[model samples]
Target: MAVDDFKAYIRKIIHVDMDAFYASVEQLDDPNLRYLPIAVGGSSKRGVVAAASYEARKYGVKSAMSGRLAAKLCPDLVFVKPRFERYQEISKRIRDIFFEYTALVEPLSLDEAYLDVTVNRKKAPSATLLAKEIRQKIREKTGLNASAGISINKFLAKIASDINKPNGQKTIAPDEVLGFLETLDVRKFYGVGKVTKDKMYQLGIFTGADLKSKSLDELQQHFGKSGAFYYQVVRGIHLSEVKTERQRKSVGAERTFNDNISSEIYMISRLEAIAEELEKRLKKHGLAGKTITLKIKYSDFSVQTRSKTLGLFIASKELILEESKALLYQERLKNSVRLLGISLHKLNSEQNSSELSAKEAAAASRKHEQLRLPF
Candidate 1:
């Protein structure tokens, strides 16, 4: 196909990500916390840092780090308890700003989302300008800064959003997508974590250009299903739409012990408590699933998952606990375990034909559509 024909099929996508959301909110609510290194979560030995302020980040503090480690990284770091309700309230306000420009919004989490503005409520011709307007509105309304990335697809847009951190935006024109992706580092790819990056490095796939050199068969042989994904994304062929109503794939809850436990009897008790929490979450969402998965995280940080699919969906704590116990004994512990979790998959929502039909219809209406770019 000619370049013009290819550009005609390109869709405008903008990924908006809030900066250090949880910790930023803490600072927003307290004037004294501004410019100081602070983390939002418990500071106890067993507690984890939910979020860290930019000031803390300079000291190598980050979310999901243990509080003890975070404090060690930044000795003066202040730890504050999470206020989820307040964060949700602020998130809603930011989302409202997004809706003003386009209804094709897919929220990835409370802190970020993908917006499709190929056809927008404001009839805007420039996604770059739309992103600017959206970010400005968020700051004015919530007193928080957001970053954005604009491109022809979700993958590139998401990656671009992180280029200028905290409060900024970057635009990758349709004509620039291929060159931009080709030189990009493999480690910068959205789903490439540390383990995957290491594997890619070992395989000599250090950049998009290197990855693009591998044949499809070679990638599949090495990386299995994810190989196909890596192949397509490197060539800028991502086709995932910005879903307006993103479905929940799974619901789960987990607990990390203060100390590793080697006792099976004690582990079962902990699993039961986790099941209770998972049950409440499942019920809160009016969801049930046919598959139950038990996630075991060892003291060494190695993880294992065991799953069983039943004939029917279940959401009760009793059934969940029953299945978890069976799976817990399914395999002997490799070493002392530090965390146990219960998750439900193949949710009832995935089986909802009406929702699927609606999604299909919406996708059909936007098929092969192109946005009018201002550049």
Candidate 2:
């Protein structure tokens, strides 16, 4: 298809996210784990749960909760260590299914992805039907349940996906959006986190309806930048696009050590892995960054970060690691480090028009400077 025709066809978007991915994977691998309360992660004193099954969630178990607390909540809750390799394998399988319909796929994480299926191979007219079939395929192939959301844009599609639980699909047609959003909870709105929610509650904004009742000035007074987002979301005017190829502003990777360590060598080993991951992502995206940041989390949960800006943008993985390792040792850390992360910030975009213009101006200026011939 021609580029303009493809652009015209790219309108319908569907977001698909598996319900309790890690826990579901565990259940798929072992039938005994099915229908039983299970939390995937560690059950040790200091460990944390990565995913909690719906059955386990009934007892208040949740992801990121301390393993100690999860066990206390559900005494029989099974904790399984995460197998990222296996998860990635399944993720690839899931993505392959998306390719059967459209090539415009944006994966949010291993378990969730957005697909632009306005023009699909199957010639499916309704996005809802496509969502349902894709979900069914995922379940039949992997013995896992996936929830799908169909909408006119990425924002609505993301919201719709979570409306229904496992093995379900929800569609929000463009015309029904206003009423649909009015009754939605404030927490469900994208970008409204714990802090924003609390502030909105103070202003008597509990639901989308309440938020819509307020004027733009009223919202902006409480939430300077985020108030605009609230105003737009309440009006069902989400401008966020379904970007298949987006220039990442940052690339980062972080990992928690097996045991807390004060030794610099152990910390470096962890940093190496993080740097490697960041490098791989940078190479995959065909991008680079001018800033390198190093983050450290102590045993007591206290966190610290250091960053340095380079003169030139660099895409070399070796250079990223070299600069990151230097930043790690540049300062003397007093406490034992439990987690380490390496990130590349201030990423240079490969397709931004403004960046291209700036490059052109700089080249022209350099040419003028050379003509001056300063001795």
Query: Tens digits of per-residue lDDT for model 2 on 1-375?
Result: 243432232247789999999998988898988899998886666678999999999999999998989999999988888888899899888988887877566778899998876656676677788888999899888878899998766777888888887778888875577788889888898778999889888888899899999888988888888788888767766656544555566888888766888988777767777778888888887788998888989999999989999999976767877888899889899799888888888888754322123443233223211111010
TM-score of each: 0.88, 0.78
- Model 1 clash pairs are none
TM-score of candidate 1 to 2 decimals: 0.88
Q: What is the lDDT of residue 169 in candidate 1?
A: 94
Model 1: per-residue Cα lDDT over 187-209, one tens digit each: 99999999999999999989899
lDDT of 1 at 120: 72
Whole-model alpha-carbon lDDT for candidate 1: 0.88
Model 2 TM: 0.78
Candidate 2 weakest ten by summed lDDT: 366-375
Question: Which regions of candidate 1 fall more than 4 Å away from where they truly are?
Answer: 199-206, 212-228, 329-334, 350-370
